[model samples]
Target: MSLHEQLYQWTASQGLDATSARRLRALSGVDDPPGDPWTPLRRGAGALAAGLIGFGLILWVAANWDDFGRAMRFGLLQAALAISLIAAAALRPWRAPLALAAFLTLGGLLAFFGQTYQTGADPWQLFALWAALGLPIAWASRSDLAWTPWALVVATGIGLWMETFGGHSWRFDASTVPVHAIGFVAYGLLCAGLALRPGAASQPWAWRLAVLASVIAISGTALGGLIARDVAPQFYLGLGVMGVGLVLAWRHSEVYAMSALALSVDTLLVVGLARWMSKERLDVGGYFLIALVACGLLAGSVTLILGRLRDAEARA
Candidate 1:
C-alpha cells in the first residue's frame, strides 16, 4: 500500500480526532494533497499541438511542392525552424513541446537540403547528423518529449548503417557475428547510459525505447541464428544480455522491461523448438506440442512476474 494509505489506516486505528489527524498528516507530509490535475492535460495539449503543427507543415510542403519555388520551400522550412527555436527559448513553460517542434523542423530542413542539393550522402548520414544536431535541443528541453524521438532517430541511423554498410550480407552466420555483437553492445551501452542518468527513474521513456530497441535487435539476430542452425557468437551474447537485463529489471521491480525481456526469450525458445521439430520431420503432433509449450512458457512468465511484484510489495 501507499504511504498515504498506511497513514490513513494508522489514524483510523488510533481513533484520532480531526485536528490530531491533520496534525499527524502535516507532520508526516505523507498525506499531502494532489497538485493541479490540469497541468498534465495542458502539457498533453501542447505536445499534441506541436505534433499537429509539424505534420501540417509537412503536408503543406508536400501538397504545394510543384507550385512553390525552390527558394520558397527552403525559406518556409527555415522560417518554421527558426520560429520553433525562438519559441522554445522564450517560453519556459512550453519549452518541451517547442523544442520537439524545433527538432522535427530541423530534420525536415536537413532532408530538404540533402534532396535539393543532392549531397551524395547515405540515408544513415542524414539521420546521424540530425540526431547529433538535435542533441542540444533535447538536453535543453530536459524532457522525454525530445529525448524519446532523439532515441528513435539514433536507433534508425544505427539500423540503416547496419543494413547498408555493416558488410553482414543480411545473414546470421559467423561472418556477421561480430557486427551483430557490436550493434547489441552499442544498444546496451545506450540503454545503460540513459538508465544511469540522474533522475532517470522519473524520465523513463528514452531508456525504455533504448531497451525495447536492443531487445528487438538481439531477438531478431538470435532467432535468425537458431533458424539457420549456425548458433553464432552473437546468439550467446544476446542470451547473456537478455539474462542480465532480466536480472536487473527484476531487482529494480521494472515490470515493463521484465515483461519485454521475458517475452523475447519465450519467442526465441518457441522458434527454436519449431526449428528442431522441422529438422526432425516430426508429425502434426509436434505442432500441438509446440503450442502447449508456448502456452506453458507464457503462463510461467506471468506467474513469475506477478510473484515478483507481490514479493516486492510485501517487502515494501
Candidate 2:
C-alpha cells in the first residue's frame, strides 16, 4: 500500500535474511556515500585526452613554419594557421576547429597585406603573401564542419575584390577588372550550401549570415553594370537582374522571392517605357506586355501543379 511497505516486500521476496535486508536498507539511506570518483580508469582517460589535444596542436604548428628567421616566427601565425589547416585535412578529429582556424588565418593574412599597403611598406611582399594564403583558405573550408565560415569569407573576399576592381585600372595584368569581379559572383554561389547549416545550430547568426550573403551577391551585379559595358542595345540590364532574382526564388524564400518578383515587374515597365522611347521602331510595349502575361500564366500553372501534389499526398 505504501512505498516503504512495497520496498520491504520486494526485499523479502529476494529471500534476504532480516539482518541482511536491514543492512542493505541502511546503506541506501537518505544520502548516498561520497568519495573521490577518479578511479584509475577515469584518470587515465582524462590524461590521454589532454595529451592528445596538446600534442596535435603542437605538431600542427611545427609542420607549417616557413624558412624565416627568429625575428619573424612571431608573425608566422600564417604558418600556424596553415598548420591547423594541415591537421584538419590529415586528422578527422580536427575538422571541428577547422572553420575557426581558417577564418582567423585568412582574415589575418588579408589584414597583413592591407596593412602593408596602408603603412607604405613592402607592398610587393604583402601582395605575395595574400596570394599564398588564398589556397589554404579555400582548401580549409572544403572540410566537414568548416564549410559555412569558409563560404562566407570567400563571398566577402569576392565582394571586397569586386569593389576594388571597379575602382582601379589594369587591376590585373592578365585581364580586366571584370574577370576578377566574376570570381566574387562565382564564390557566392559556391558557398550558398553553407547557409543550410545555421538552421541546425539554432543560432540566429547563421540565418543572419544567409541574408548578408544575398545582399552581397545582389550588390556585385549592380557593380557589374558600372565596370563592364556589355549590354545588348536591344535588351535591358534589368532583364539580367530579374533573371538572377528568379533563379534565387526557385532556390530559397524570404526577401529573395519578393525581390525577384519586383525586379521582373520593373523590367516589364522599363520595356514599356522603351517602346515610347521608340527603339528602332520596334514594338517594345507589345513585347513587354506579352512577357508580363506569360509570367502570370506560369505562376498560375505552378500553383495548380503544387496544389495537385498536395492533394494527392493528403489522400494517401
Candidate 3:
C-alpha cells in the first residue's frame, strides 16, 4: 500500500475521533487536493505562443527591410524589447512567456546591430555578450524555458571562442590532439558544473543538456585517439569517462547520468575488438569466438545498467 493509505489506516485503527483523524490525514497530506491536469497544457501553450510571436517578429522585420529607414528599424526593435519587458513585469506570476519573448527580441536586436554596423568583432564575442545580457531576464523569470536556450547560446559562444581565439584547430592529428583533448576536458568540466548547479533539479533539461555536452566532449577526445591509432589514450579516456559516470550515478542517482558509462563501455568493447583483430591477427574462427564473447559481455553490462537506470528513474 502507498504511504498515505498506510497512514490513514493507522490513524483510524487508533480509535481517534473523526475530526482528529481528518486533521491527521490532512496534515500528513493523505487528504491533499487533486492536481490540476491543465497546468502542463497551459505552460506548453504559453511557450508555443512565445515562439510564434518571436518568429513572426523576425519575419516581419525581414519583409520590411528595404522600406524601413535605419532609425525606424532600431526604434521598432527597441520598442518591442521595452514592451516585452513591461509585459513580463505586469504579468508577475505568469511572466515566462513575456520573459522568453524579451530574450528572443534581444537576440534579434543584436543580430540587427551586427548586420548594420559591421563591428569587426569575433562571432563568439557577440554571442557571449548576448548571453551575458540575457542572464537577468532568465534569472528573474526563474523558468527553464528561459534558461535552457540561454545556456545553449552561452555554450555555443564559449565553444566558438575557444576554437578561434584559444589557438586551436579541428584537426585530429598528433599536433592538435593534446590541445583538443585539453579543450574537451575544460568544456566538459564547465558542462558538469552546470549540471550540478543548485536549483538544476527543477530544470532537468539544463542538467540533461549539460550531461550530453560533457559526454560528447569526452567522446570526441576518445574518438580522436582511436583515429590516431593510439590505443593507450583511447583506452584511458574511455575509462575516465566511465569512472565519472559511475560517480554521478552513485552519488546523484540520476537516470540520464549513466549515459556516459554505457557509451564508454561500448567504446571499450569496440576498441578491444579492433586491437585484437589488428595486433593478434587471429584466425577467422578465433575472431568469431572473441566477437561472440564480447557481445555477450556488452549485453550483460547493458542489462545491468538498464536495471539501475529504471531504479534511478523511480527514485527521481
**Ranking according to lDDT, highest score first:** 1, 3, 2
Report the Cα lDDT for candidate 1: 0.85
lDDT of 1 by residue, 112-199 (tens): 9999999899898999999999989988998888888998888877777766655625676677766777777777777887788756
| Model 3 bad stretches (over 4 Å) | 1-35, 165-168, 173-182, 185-189, 196-198, 229-242, 268-276, 279-298, 306-316
The C-alpha lDDT values of all candidates are: 0.85, 0.49, 0.72
- Better-scoring candidate (lDDT), 1 or 2: 1
Q: Is candidate 1 or candidate 2 better by TM-score?
A: 1
User: How well does candidate 1 match the true structure in TM-score terms?
Assistant: 0.84
Which residue pairs show backbone clashes in model 2?
none
Q: How many clashes in each structure?
A: 0, 0, 0
RMSD of each: 4.8, 17.2, 6.4
Return the clash pairs for model 1, or none.
none
Which of the two, 1 or 3, has more lDDT?
A: 1
Lowest lDDT sum, 10 consecutive residues, model 1, at 161-170
